[model samples]
Target chain A: MVNLAVKIKDLELKNPVMTASGTSGFGEELADFYDVDKLGAILLKGTTLRNRDGNPYPRMAETASGMLNAVGLQNKGIDYFIENIYPRIKDYNTPLIVNVNGSTIEEYIEVTQRVNELDKIPAIELNISCPNVKEGGMLFGTSCASAETVTREVRKAYSKTLIVKLSPNVTDIAEIARAVESEGADSVSLVNTFLGMAIDAEKRIPLLSTITGGLSGPAIKPIALRMVWQVSRAVKIPVIGMGGIMNATDAIEFFLAGATAIQVGTAIFRDPFTPLQIIDGLEDYLNRHQIDDICKLVGALKY
Target chain B: MPSNRIRMKKNVGEFTIVSNSALNNTNYHICLQSDIGLPDIAPGQFTNVDIPNNKDIFLRRPFSFFDVDYEKKTVSLLVKILGRGSKSLTELKVGSKLNLVYPLGRGFTIPDKNDKVLAVGGGSGVAPILQLAKTAGSSPGQMHIAIGARSAEDHISIADYLQFAQFYFTTEDGSLGEKGFVTDHPIFHDLTQYNRIYACGPLPMMKAIAARAKEAEIFCEVSLENLMACGFGVCLCCIEPTVKGNLCVCTDGPVFNIKDLKW
Candidate 1:
């Protein structure tokens, strides 16, 4: 059997196929269609210190091969997550990574501190790159200074593996990646949703409630791969790559491009079983290539 | 809620076009019948129809289960050709094979016996309201339907409602019964007359009806047409913020009580 285990700092993923946050709701939602334990990891939806109502109606707008969402990071806050969601999902076999979003530096530390107390929660992904919310989402992620500050503060409060999620809507993504890594981030996930918008030509109005929204799907795959490649080369820490991963072939491309693990985001919306299918596909790919260890594929790109 | 995902069972149904009438300058109503056994589809539930012309519209366009004939295994649809995805749906031939994902979305709740129900619909939203009227019609004469459109031509023929209950129509251009909005119609002026209210349509229209029903403290439910990729709730795109928190519109409801919705 091909060894599929890959390590990201202290934590080890069964495979490189993990569900991206926001796309997969707490991992329990997809359990009906596919076995949740089959996935390498489940990145739960973005959680905040307080409950957020999110934006108004028409939060999603469909494009040619993709979709734009301005969901505004609506969640039941961190406390309810610990009390209601965690206890249930903790029973699942897959590693659980809580995606934390904060409006302020202190909020980030507070949520990370709470997550550090949970025994079942293996890691915390500090989401500094959400484009939909009005406050502190992509704001902290765009600038290197804010990104490092948030990562460093959370690193101080919590001892678990800290993954700083970076936004694609930046001048130099490598600068931000380096900033997070220098601030003691365990690893980094790159290429959060790209900012996009759609219009109803007839109505002469924007489709989403929020005029501009975060775009995700096959449309952004190439750009995501480029960012993942650049950031992987720039940082010493492991990189988790995600964008428009639809199948195993796409997952292999990310691994070849230097991602330690890959997250399936938009594809899950189309087929809930995609991540599991990807895991199985990766196994077949490794067996065919005669690669004994999957970790060898990390940053294997030749000059 | 337990994951409702199950192995998709394919069922083919044959349907004939009874009438293809132009509802407005742009929209058309293409009604059809099927020989195969049809599943139980509730109001607010929709069918994903595959269109032949455009390959880009890979996913089926979701249409509300406008009307159903169980004995004949037939279904009717009010198709408004708003885009290329919908325009392709209107061009189907009389004996065409239409692949459909039937009975998707949570339907409206049926009112208890002896309860007076007021059903409101606007634009293409009239489909489910009519279906609810048919479902509620078995009670003799307890169902009331109020439909609104921009003009008289925008209103689809509702001959099926003759046997159900009272029917009210409103058009903005004053071509039909009342020359105003559905809320402005004389029938809806007295919200206390109905024991329960059900509405679906444009967000603003549903919100207006919901507000009126709430002020009267009447039990009211609304079906939201949130943008959805997978009608099975996997997308997390069709989420509606409700009193119960964020719930999937495809699974938790296309149908939700007005009280539950934060709007």
Candidate 2:
């Protein structure tokens, strides 16, 4: 039998497949389609310290092979999440990981400290890489020093598996990964959406309300894979790769590129069943390749 | 008012195209048969339909449920050719397969048995307004529907609606009914007559109707058509600012009471 189980620090994942934060929305939406308990982990949507109105209407624009979004972490703050959302999702059989975000270091630390009290939530994916927000998000992730500093501060507040999600809108993602690793991050997830813009030629107006938003989908897989490969080699912690993973083959490519586990993001917008399909496909791939454990495929890319 | 049962679960499965008939140059009536049994779908609720075989269109397009048949396990949609996604959907064959995340969002609150109602619609928004009229189970003289379009040809046929409610129409070019917008019609001027007002159309038209309804102290609800990514609450792309703060148009509503809106 192919053992699909994997681990990140002390947190155990039943499979390498997981739903990316901001895409899954606390794993409630996908529960309508299939049992989310079958997946490795569920990353809740980006939660902030305070309720954010986010941007105005026209937040999404469809592009070639992908789409752009300027949602800007529009959550009801950590209090509402802890009171309303957390209680509902906390009991899901899979490990529930909160994708925590903030506009300031104090906000991030405070949000992290609050989540630390939730016993059901085994980990928190620190999001310093959101491109759509006007402040703090991508600003902290793009630089090595700030990435290290935020990771360092959040680390002190929370005592759990800390996965620092890195932004691709950087010159050296590998260096940023190492910086977070030095600050005591348990693991790192790579290639949060790349910054991009869309326009309407005839109307002479930008498509998205923000003018520019984060680009994600199949259009970004190759670049994300390369970053995952580079970061996985640079850090001792596990690398959760994600960007444009539509199906299992795309996920297998990430495993070959060095991702210990992978997250399905924008693809979930197209097909809600994609993460489950990927889990099944991974097992099929293992059976075909005569591999016993799925972990063997991680970083198996040959020169 | 018909108390809509809040259906917590949603489905994602393939539906085969039963038929695709053009109502006009810009609009098409497409019916889809579900592989799984049809769930109870309410008016103002929508579906995120996948536009397959089109590499250029990546995201699923959201459309309000125009008609649903439980016996046949089918749902029909009123698709207006707005962009590449809707245009691609109109070109699909009868046997084509479409995946959908369906019966999403809270629907309009059906009027009370004795309450008089008025529903206004235009463009892509006409779908749900028509559905609300047909299914409200109102007696004669209780339900009135007004539809507006830029020109005569832009308006789809509502011959099937005569049995359910009284119909009113207005065109910009004055080709079909009264001239100018639906608000220009006499039905909109007398807002006190309607116990509840429901609108689904362009923002300007709904806002105008909402203003009149508010002045007359009538309860009013309007369905919004926002650019959506995921048809569920997760994306938070389709948001409408209300008294409760920024609520997802996909979840908190594609349908909202005018009073709750900041507008």
TM-score of chain A of each: 0.98, 0.99
Q: After superposition, how far is residue A131 of candidate 1 from its true place, in Å?
A: 2.4
Winning candidate number (lDDT): 2
Clashes of each: 3, 1
What is each candidate's fraction of native interface contacts (fnat)? 0.26, 0.84
Evaluate model 2 with DockQ and give the value: 0.59
Screening candidate 2 with a backbone cut-off below 3 angstroms (N, C-alpha, C), the clashing residue pairs are B1-B112
Model 2, stretches more than 4 Å misplaced? B1-8
RMSD of each: 4.7, 3.0
> Candidate 2 docking: what grade?
medium
Cα lDDT for residue A303, candidate 2 = 95
